[model samples]
Target: MNNMIAPSILSADFANLERDLKRVSEAEFIHVDVMDGSFVPNITIGAPVAKAIRKHIKGIMDVHLMIQNPDMFINDFKDAGTDYLTVHIEACTHLHRTIQRIKEKGMKAGVSLNPATPVCLLEPIIDDIDLILIMSVNPGFGGQKFIPYSLEKIKQVKKMIGTREILIQVDGGVTLDNAKEIIDAGATVIVAGSAIFNAPDVEQRIQDFKSLML
Candidate 1:
């Protein structure tokens, strides 16, 4: 399978969002981190801002909701033009129902696991989700170092997935140095924040990441 890149907008220049979005236009998806301040220590943008961002990006809007009770705002996000909606497995009380709701809204349902969370926790719901996002760093912030153990976790999840069509995505601290190893470990999608937005040349940085898949 072809590896994909999703550039997180958390590290983007919010004041010049249109230009920043254009910079990463080559990416397969645009990762929108939605933090509610309760689940995560920091609060990022919400559905309104996500709707605004959808208007600027050319690729799919992949929204990762790091919130408490994501069910409450599922419809709101769906209305915001989210192509893929990912809820934290730790936050969802009824994960299956939430995943069902996402699918019902015609959006790809994805489940995200924190760095500390084990891949075995997803065994039961592995076949249900369209995507599995394995966090290489903790969920609260960006620019953190990638946890080395996440590569092992990706390998475990890939073995558990077997012949399933579900996509395995690795998020946080994805840079050129680690991108190849992450993909080699079985991640189909890579989510990068600082590595892309913090770079001097955003388009070239994306191209560099794409080169790893080659």
Candidate 2:
């Protein structure tokens, strides 16, 4: 897959979401971080918000569910116009079944791993999913520093994937300073939040990231 930027809306201006989204409209995908307090210690938007967001952008909607029981919301998100439904592997009881349900719902299925979750554990269902999301920082909150170890993890995932046509997405703490390094490490799709939205020139910041993409 080609290198792509998925700008996370977690750092966008909630009061002016439409305007903020327009700023990063050129990005390949718009990442939605859906958090439920029980799973991630913070609560964010839900399917209804996603449905509303769908009306504004034509690009891919990469919805990352940081909530427990993600399977129950599969169809909800599908109806909300989610192009990709990413669920945390740490949250699912039956990961394979959840992935199948997502595919059955006509949406691309993605599995996400926390910072501590090793790539080797994903082997059993690696071939079954469409994408693998690597969390560079802990979930729930945004704007945390990217863990240095994530780069090595990304390389490991790349080697483990070998020739499989799977997207390796790195989320959290992505900035212009370390983006190229992360991409070089094997992250196909990058999930950046404050780094892009909090910049003085949001669109230009996104372009800067695009320039670094493969």
Candidate 3:
């Protein structure tokens, strides 16, 4: 399989977002990290910004909701042009319903797990999800170290979703150093923040990261 590189816009220059988005055109999708103070202790953009982004970028918007009540905003996000809407398994009170709601809106539903969240917790609901986002660092921030244990988590989740055709995604601390390792461990999609957005030559960095997937 050809691995995917998704550059997170959280670490990009918010003032010139379109320019930054253009710089990472090689990316399979634009990874948007939505954080509410209650869920991850940080506040970021919501529906309006997401809508504006959709109008400017032609790539897929893989929106990750790190908020407490993802169900409350699922419809809004889908309407805002989110191609894939992922909610934290820990945040949703009714994961199946939320996933069903996302599909009902005609978007792919994904399940995201924090670094401390166990992979086994997904066994019961794995069949309902289109993708699984494994956070290599805690959800609140970006540019942190890729937790070594996430590789094992990816392997286990990949195994659990066997023959179901679920895509496995890894977010946080994805850099050239370990991009290959994560893919080798079974992640089809990789989300990078500082490694791609903060690089001196942003476009080259994306290509360099993409090369590692080979």
Best candidate, lDDT-wise?
A: 2
TM-score of each: 0.98, 0.98, 0.98
lDDT (C-alpha) at residue 190 in model 1? 94
What's the candidate order when arranged by decreasing lDDT? 2, 1, 3
Query: lDDT tens digits, residues 1-214, model 2?
Result: 7899999999999989999999999998999999999999999999999999898886999999999999889989999999999999999999999999999989999999999999888999988988999999999898999999999999999998999999999998899999999999999999999999999999999899999994
Candidate 3 regions with alpha-carbon error over 4 angstroms: none
Q: Model 1, range 1-214, lDDT digits (tens) per residue?
A: 7889999999999899999999999999999999989999999999999998888889889999999999999999999999999999999989999999999999999999999898888988887899999998988999999999999999999999999998899998888999999999999999999999999899999999998987
Candidate 3 lDDT for residue 185: 93
Tell me the tens digit of each residue's lDDT in model 3 across 1-76: 5688899999999999989988988788899999999999899999889999897666789999999989899878
Each candidate: RMSD to true structure? Answer: 0.8, 0.7, 0.9
- Looking at model 3, report the run of 10 residues with the lowest lDDT sum: 51-60
Candidate 3 overall Cα lDDT vs. reference? 0.91
CA lDDT for candidate 1: 0.93
C-alpha lDDT (0 to 100) for residue 200 of candidate 3: 96
